[model samples]
Target: MNDEINYTNNPLHGLGLQELLTQIVDHYGFEILYAYLNINCFKTNPSIESSVKFLKKTEWAREKVEIFYLYQYKNLPRVSSEQFELPPRKRIIPEGQTPREPAELSFEDAERVREKQAKKAAEHGKSKRYKEREFENLWKR
Candidate 1:
């Protein structure tokens, strides 16, 4: 049985960089994008043309924007890690899964997300140090 996943259903499949950027900018604006994405292109002198040009030249940033477009703007369900390895344009949406309404986002919500991420990172760092100290103590005994 053939198990090929059809990617044509993805909204990003044939969408141009300019068009994608324009849609998000129209809905969310550059300020909200910068707050959530932290991309300099969106933050500094942001414009649809400038952002599209920058994203065209930059692979990582383009991928980031595409991902934000899929997960946040299109409100698609999160993909499995294997599927996520593919670009958002190529990732396969499971059968019966369709895009939903764009998420309601705000600058304040972005700030809260950043704070939560920072807290998680600090906790991870503390645990790593504790583990290292424990390892050293085990060797010294």
Candidate 2:
């Protein structure tokens, strides 16, 4: 007997990025997407192709779109009152509903999150260096 992991509870499993974008575009036009996400792809001459290409290349933007889908489109229940949150895989899905698969963020989203963290870390390093320089300058004076 083969044991297969059932992901029926997940709301983002089987859906592809293209389909997700299409559904979103259909439900809410580019204008609304632009207003909501503030992505340039939606703002300036938006098209599925262009948006998909941009999303594929840019991780942060893709994560934003995925987050929007999880919150606005899927309508999943909120986790708790905690300020910090768990990743989607750890969160429990509501029972009795056939959740859309692919709940986990896409590869692009994950990469984007990493890139964002790296950028923040770089900025923090810069700040630290600046502070150290200022301290050294004070000593020199």
Candidate 3:
């Protein structure tokens, strides 16, 4: 079976690093980028060429810029504390849409939700403890 990854929903797919830098620079300009990223490329004699060079060499700085693009510029829905953390590829894209407000829950529904969360937490703790034990056993061998 042939499987292909579809990037239709991904905002960062077609865009190159240079293009990303240029778009961000066009939208926010170098001074604002400098304020947000606080990188030397944006602060000192800033240019698209220089910033791209810096971002290419620095992984952390590149991630920051990409995150800024996703959250600030693209305005994707903010991740909720309760939801499982997802990587960029796994996250749902909002495509310029406003985030929907969470629905109000009744007392019973709220209690149920809390119980569910506690159960999930307990399960996660068990798995973590099991992994630690496994690692300890491996070291003893």
Taking every candidate in turn, the Cα RMSD to the unseen true structure, in Å, is 10.0, 13.4, 14.1
Taking all chains together, the TM-score of candidate 1 against the true structure is: 0.79
Q: lDDT values of the candidates?
A: 0.75, 0.58, 0.57
Best TM-score goes to which candidate? 1
Summarize candidate 3's per-residue lDDT along 40-84 as a digit string, tens digits: 898899999988888889776776676566655665555443311
* Backbone collisions counted per model: 0, 8, 0
Question: Order of candidates by TM-score, top first?
Answer: 1, 2, 3
Q: How accurate is candidate 3 locally (lDDT)?
A: 0.57
Residue-level lDDT of model 2, residues 23-138, one tens digit each, is 88887678766755668999898999999999989876776676566655675545343311433333345566443433333345435544554566566675643432322222
Alpha-carbon TM-score of each model against the true structure: 0.79, 0.56, 0.56
Residue-level lDDT tens digits of model 1 in 1-141: 132347676778778999999999999999999987778999899999999999999887787788778878888876765775566678778878888889888878788766665566566675643433322222121
Task: Assess candidate 1 and give its lDDT.
Answer: 0.75
Alpha-carbon runs more than 4 Å astray in model 2: 1-8, 80-92, 97-141
Model number with the top lDDT: 1
After TM-score superposition, the amount by which residue 127's alpha carbon in candidate 1 deviates from its true location, in angstroms, is: 17
Alpha carbon RMSD to native, model 2? 13.4
Instruction: Please report, as a residue range, the 10-residue window in candidate 3 with the lowest summed lDDT.
Output: 132-141
